[model samples]
Target: MLLTSRSLSRLGHWAAGLLTGLVAMAAHSAPLVMAIGDSTLFAPLQLAAQEGFFAAEGLEVQVIGCINGRRCLKHLTDGEAQVATVADTPMVFALHAGHRFDIIATFGSSSRDTALVARTDRGIAKPADLAGKRIGVVRGTSAHYFTNVFLLVNGVPRDSVNLVFIDPIRGAEPLLRGEVDAAGLYRPTGPQALEQLGAKGVQLPTLRPYTVMVNLVAQPGLSQDTLLRLLKAAQRGVALLNGQPGRAHELLGARWKLDARHAAAQLDGYEFRLSLDQTLLSTLEAESRWAVREGLVESRAVPDYLELMRVEPLRALDPRAMTIVK
Candidate 1:
């Protein structure tokens, strides 16, 4: 049917309005690149992405997987990712390197996450046995910090053992190839390494030396509104993790192809919660000192960790989550 000029004009306006709405939606959903470590420690973030929590928060998140937390933070520094999942150790190193970012929230933590998997054949039956032997560790990571603390706790001097810096992506390959007697690894890697070693490997019996704080870091200028939305989404993910742990594990195992037993063990070791607490400050301070003392980072005064944290976002999301005194 032929349309009147007035009708045609109305139709044009409707079409224009429809196009405008579509453009606004597209802009709103522009994907935010989140560089995340491929480890069980980041279960909350991973779950949030996989379970539609991010989308539910009206945030389009595109995750870039890195081999370790250090690399994940590196992506943030290099501008490849707007946000990253990193542990306290990497944050300390990144601070030392003058890379500025804000710790938005700590989503997970575990004392038993990092361990030394020693080859029985290398006479490394106990933690002390690591003395004078080669130990493989991922440099500039929680595994690296854990290795030092583990040795010190076991009465092994840092200089006594030969530290073989291995690639984070390689896990325990150096140990598997007999290049190192033991490998300091984080979960999934630690379990996989022990499994691969069969009866030939043993994890040293040492008290938990380090509690890695798995954190979400934002680029320096990330808006508080965006941060709050991200944290809110992660809070929902944390609720899923804590409330229905079995379902969370099932989802994680399916998405990451984790062994059922390994997934359960990994999940059990972690406590997923959203917080910006004093413990996080204490851990960052301790890690900073350790990094400098161990010559891991160049000698420099520790940056004010409180300054590095952006607590307002978490506070705005949930006041209880912001326990950081400052």
Candidate 2:
């Protein structure tokens, strides 16, 4: 049927409105680049990207996986990614190095993730046996800090053992090749090393002094709306992790090519959620002081960590999750 002039005008108006809406959506749908670490500690980031959570939130996210948090944060600092996944150690070291950035939120944390793995045949059946042994560590990362704290808590002096610097992604290699008697490792690497070593590899006992905080950091000057979208997507990823454990395990296992049992074991021990809290600030300050005392950084005084984080985005998302004072 031929349309009347009046109906044709109405159809034209409807088509114009549709075109305007599509243009606005296209403008806001710019691809967001996130440089994420390979550890399960940053599982939320991976889940968000892989499970279509970010896409569901009208975001096109590109994930660039790094060997460790330090390199992930480097991708952000070098202008490669708008967002990065990192732990407390790299942020402290970066701040001391004069690089400005913002911590949007901490997505996960765990006390049991970082541990010392040793070859039992090497007579290292216990933490005290670590003395004078060449210990492999990823220098300047959370594993390095945990190695020191593990030693101190086990009554071994810091300088007593030799620390063999190892690559972050290949943290367990030195111990696997017998280059170092023990290695302080985090997830994926830790579990993988133990599995490869079978009964010969043992995780030494410790007080578990440090809890690695997996954080989402943003490059300075990112728009708040974009940051909020990223956090919201991450929050959904955390929900999938907590709400659907079996699916999360399966998906993560498939992503990393681990068997179901290995994936479940590796993914255990973490509390995945989005928050900006006092404990994070305290952890940063402690790491900062440790860095200074160890001569890792030139700055003697601890920088005010509050300046390094922007809690408004997280607060806007969930007021209850914003527990950090000021």
Candidate 3:
């Protein structure tokens, strides 16, 4: 029998209500995240995306490549990316410059792969031997900050060294061709530079007494639930990296053109974690103070270092959720 018009109207209403409910659930369920960082941090994102960890967390994440610290900070402040990796120095500077960002977690802290490389012919033996020599560096970057600190700590005057601004990727060429006596670069860029130019180099210690290599940061407005999901996902990714180095190496090689051996070596040097603990907090605060004293930040605008950190999400997650890298 044919349905009456009244029945059809009631059926339409039911369907509409069901559709609305479904849409609301989807909206509340999946959070969108934007990540920006150097090639190293980008490696895990590529792997995690392939492994579906973000999907498991009810998140839709967009990972973007940003090598420059200043540009990454600008993208984050302009709302182009919600979560990004920034060097500890630039994070401190951004805080003092009045941009609002929250540090979600610390991932990598090793500076072992970060080096001050020189052409063998340049006759540069140590940090102190570089006086009156031109050194190529990415100005206003972590490498640059570290280089400056290295000079000062080694009792080398700022004026005694000549700094040439250049892209870190292309820096080795200038050094190899005798354009500069030395170049400051971070791995795998540092490794690539040494391999390509067949140049001899010396690894430098952490420039600042307590400096972190990179940390995850988010915009100020993410909901607590969303933040928690993100931290859990990231922590899971770190665990995955530690347990499956071979797979992690393959992922890095495919996405970032990183050599498997080199990638594995780099990962081996780091102890990955999702914590922004007292050591990290204290280290960042001390570095920020050093920046202010060194004129990297305005003396009067120093924000509380703790204010820059947001660790509740990581703390809320079960400790069993993370894999501690040995």
In model 3, the clashing pairs are none
**Tens digit of lDDT per residue, candidate 2, span 288-317?**
888898898987878888977898899999
Clashing pairs for model 1 are none
Identify the superior model by TM-score, candidate 2 or candidate 3.
2
After superposing all C-alphas onto the true structure, candidate 3 shows an RMSD in angstroms of: 6.1
Could you tell which candidate, 1 or 2, scores higher by lDDT? Answer: 2
Q: Which stretches of candidate 1 lie over 4 Å from their true place?
A: 1-29, 259-261
How close is every model to the real structure, measured as TM-score? Answer: 0.89, 0.89, 0.80
Top candidate when judged by lDDT against the true structure: 2
Cα lDDT of model 1 by residue, 1-326, tens digit: 99999999999999999999999898667788999787888888888888888889988889998888899999999999999999888888889988899889999999989888999998878887888999998888898888888987888988898998998767778889899999889988898889999999998988656788899999988778788889988898899888987888788888778766557877776888888899989888888888888787875789999988888888888898887788
Give the candidate number with the greatest TM-score. 1
Ranking by TM-score: 1, 2, 3
Instruction: Residues 79-151, candidate 3: write the lDDT tens digits.
Output: 7888777767677677777888887777666655456776656677766778888888876566776677677
Put the candidates in lDDT order, highest first.
2, 1, 3
What's the true lDDT of residue 243 in model 2? 95
